[model samples]
Target: MLNIYKMYSEFLSSNIPYGGQYASVVKLLRSAKREILKLIKTFLEKDEKKPHIGKHFVPPLMDAVLADYARNFPDARESEVLSLFAAIINQYKVAMKDEVPRIFESVFLCTLEMITKNFEDYPEHRLKFFSLLRAIATYCFPALLQLTSEQLKLVMDSVIWAVRHTERNIAGTGIKLLLVFLNNFKKSDFCNQFHQTYFMQIEQEIIAVLTDTFHKPEFEWHVMVLQRLFSLVESGSLTEPLWDASTVPHQYPNNADYVCECTIKLLSSAFPNIMENKDLYGEEAAAKLLRERQRMLLVLGLIAPKMTDS
Candidate 1:
C-alpha cells in the first residue's frame, strides 16, 4: 500500500522521541514498525529507483532504535542486526520500490559493521543479506547504469576480502555482489567496446578467489558460491528466448543447455530452486515434476534445519 510508504515517510519526517514523552515514544515506535513492514513489500515490487526509501530514512531510523536499546541495555552484545536488516530486506520490495541501489549502498556498507562486532550472531541471515544485495544490483545498476569504475573497484575489493577471511556466509554474499557487478555489463558502454571487454576480465578473478576458497572442505558445501556462477549462467540462458526476438538485443549468445544442466545439478546436488518457476515442469512431466518437489523439499530442509544440536 502506498499508504504504508507515506506513513513511514511521515513518521521519519517527525521528530523521534517527540516531546520526550513515554506514551508518544511507544506509539511512534509501534506504528513505525508496522509501516516499515508494509513499505518493504511496496518497494520491492516496483523497478529499482527506490526514491522514498534511502539513507535518509533507513539509517536514521536504525540509529535511533539501536541507540535507545544500547542506552537501556548497555550490555547489548551480539543482538539481531541481521534479523532487523533481514526484516527490512524481506519486505524491501514493497518498501524500497524506486530506491534499490541506494538501499544496496546502505545495506552492503552497514553489514560490514556486523563483522566488526559479532559476526557469528548473523551467520543465519548472512547469505540472504547477500542475496538481497544482488537483487538490488540486478534491478538497479543496469537500469540506470550508475555504478562507476571507482565503485566497481571498491566492490571488487569487498569481494576479495569476503572470499579470503570471512565465513562461508560472507563469502557467498561477496560472490553475489561480484556477480551483480559483472552482470552490470548489460547496461555498460563496455558492451559495445570489444568482442569481450575488460569488464569480462573480472570473471577470472572471481573464479580464482571462489575456487581457492572452495578448496577448504569446510566451505565447500556453500552452494551460494557455486550458485553465484550458476546465477550468471542461468541469467544468460533464461534470456536466450528474449534475445531471439528481432527488436530485442542479441549481441552475444550464451549456451542454453549449459545453463539448464547446471541449474538441474544445483537442484539435485545441493540448493533446490524452491522459489523456482512454477511452469518449468508441467504436471505431465513426472521426472521434471519430481525434480521440482525435490528442490522444494531441499529448501525446507535447509531453512528449517533440525531444532536440536544432534
Candidate 2:
C-alpha cells in the first residue's frame, strides 16, 4: 500500500501536465488513487485495534494528499486529493484536531479559491470540497472551531454560495452541509452566535432559492434548513437584537414576523401571474404551476405559521 501511494505521489510531483493528451492517463491514475484512498480509509478505520496503521501509515498519506493539492492542477481530477483528506479526517476524527487547520488550508481554502469565482469551473472540486467539509464538520467538529474567525467566516460564506448555485448537485450538497453544521453545534454558544450574525441573511437566501421555480427540486432541502433555522430562533436557542440592535426600537417583534411578511410579499407577487393566466397551458404545465403554488402555500400555511407561533 505504501509503495502504491508513493508511486501516485511521485506521479503528482512529476511534470506531467494534466488534461489535454494526458487526459486518459490522468483518468487512469485518478482511478488508482481512489482505490488507494479506499484502502487508506479501511486501514484507518481499524487503526484503533492496530495502532501501527495510525502511527506508521496515516501521517505519510496525509502528507501525500497535501502535496498533491499543492500541485494545483487545473483539471477537476484535483478533487481526488481532497477525497483523500476527507477519508483521513473521517477515520481519525478528533485525533486529527491539531492537523485540521493544515487540512483546511490545503483542501478547503484552496478548493474554495478555485471554485468560488465561477461555479461553472472545476465542478468536481465543488462537490468534493463540500464533501470534505461534511467530513470535518461531522467527524471532527471541534477542529472547525479551531479555525480563526476569518477562516470560519469564509467557510460559512462558501457553503452559502454553494446553496445558491444553479447546479442541483452542488446546491443539494450545500444545503445538506449547512444542515450538518447547524445540527452538530445547535446546542453550543457557537450556533447561537452564528444565527445571531447570519440568521437573517441565511434565511433570506434560503427563501429566495425556495421560491425560485428553477429550484423546485431542492424544495424539501430548503424547507428542512429553514425549519432548523426557525427552530433555533423560536426555542430561544438563537437570541435577539435580531432586528435592529443599533436603534432604540426593534424593527420586528421576532424573527417569525419578519419571515412571514417576506412570505406574504412573495405570494402576493406570484399570485397575480397565476390568476391572470388562467389558461391551463397544458396538463403538465398546469400541474407544475399548481405544484409550485402548493409549495408556496406550504411555506406560508405550514412553515410560516409555525414560525409565527414562535
Candidate 3:
C-alpha cells in the first residue's frame, strides 16, 4: 500500500500530460479499490491502537490527493477528475467509519484552504468546489458539527464569499449550502460564539448583494439570495437586530428608519426592470419578471413589520 501511494505521488509530480496520466492513475486506483479499502481498514484498526493514522498518514494523504486534484482538474468541465476524487474520498469514508471524524476534519479544512488559495486561479471550478462543499455538508455533517467556533466562522465566511460570487449559479449553490448549514445546526451554534454582531455582518453582506440590479432574465438567480434571506428572517434565526443599518450608508436615527430606507431603495432598483418591457417581452419572460418583483416585495413585506417595531 505504501509502495502504491509512493508511486502515485511520484506520478503526480512527474512531467507527464495530466489528462492521460490522471486517467491511467484513476483506472489503476479503481482496479485496486478493494485491496486499498482492506488496507485502509487495517490502518484504521492500527489508528485505534496506535494513533498513527490520525497523527501522520491521513493528513498527508488528504493533502496529496487534494493537491493533485487542484493541479490537474482545476476546471469545472473536468467532471471525470472530480468524480474520481469524490469516489476516492467516499471510499475512505466507508473504510474509516469510526475514524472518519479526524480524517474528515483534515480533509474538510484542507478543501477550504485549497479553495481559498486557488479561487482566483481556477474561477471556472468555483461551482465544482461548491458542489464538493455541499456533499461535505450533506454526508459528513457530523464532522462539521465538531468544528470549533473559529473554524465555523471560517466556514461562514466562505459561504458569504460564495453568496457574493459574481456567477449566478455559484452564488445560488452557496445559498443552498448556507440553508443546509442553518438547517443542521441550531441558531446558537453560530450565535453563541460569534454573537449577533457577526450575524449582522453576514446579513449586511447578503443584503448588499441582494440590492444589486441584474437584467430581467437573471432575476431568478437574484431571487434565490433573497429567498434564503427570507428563510433566515422567517425562522427567527436571523433577527431584525442583526440587520446592520450602516450597510446602507445612510444616516438614520434608528434601525427602523435605516431598514425602511434600504427597503425603498431595493424597491426602486427592482421596479424599473420589472416594469420595463412588460408588454414587449414574451409571456414567459413577463411572468418571470413579475414573479421576481413579487419575491422582492414579499421579502420586504416580511421584514417591514420587524423593522417598523425596531
TM-scores, one per candidate: 0.38, 0.72, 0.48
What's the true lDDT of residue 207 in model 3?
A: 61
Query: Once superposed on the true structure, which residue ranges of model 2 sit more than 4 Å away at CA?
Result: 1-14, 17-35, 42-52, 247-310
Off by over 4 Å in 3: 1-6, 14-120, 123-125, 186-198, 213-310
Which regions of candidate 1 are displaced past 4 Å? Answer: 1-97, 101-105, 113-128, 187-204, 210-310
Which candidate do you rate higher for lDDT, 1 or 2? 2
**Which pairs, if any, clash in model 2?**
none
Candidate 1, TM-score vs. the true structure? 0.38
Error of 3 at 83 (Å): 4.4
> What is candidate 2's lDDT per residue for 1-310, written digit by digit as tens?
6667667656644535643676677667767877777666666666675446656766776676676666546553456667767777777667777777788776666677789888688887788888888888888888787778788789889989989999988888899898898887785658756766677778778888898877788899999988987776666655554555574244777667765665566556757776567565778887997787667766745646664443
C-alpha lDDT score of every prediction, in listed order: 0.47, 0.74, 0.55
Query: What would the per-residue lDDT of candidate 1 be over residues 32-86, giving only the tens digit for each residue?
Result: 6545544543553342554456445565655544333333221221123334444
Candidate No. with top TM-score: 2
| Global fold similarity of model 2 (TM-score) | 0.72
Candidate 3, pairs of clashing residues: none
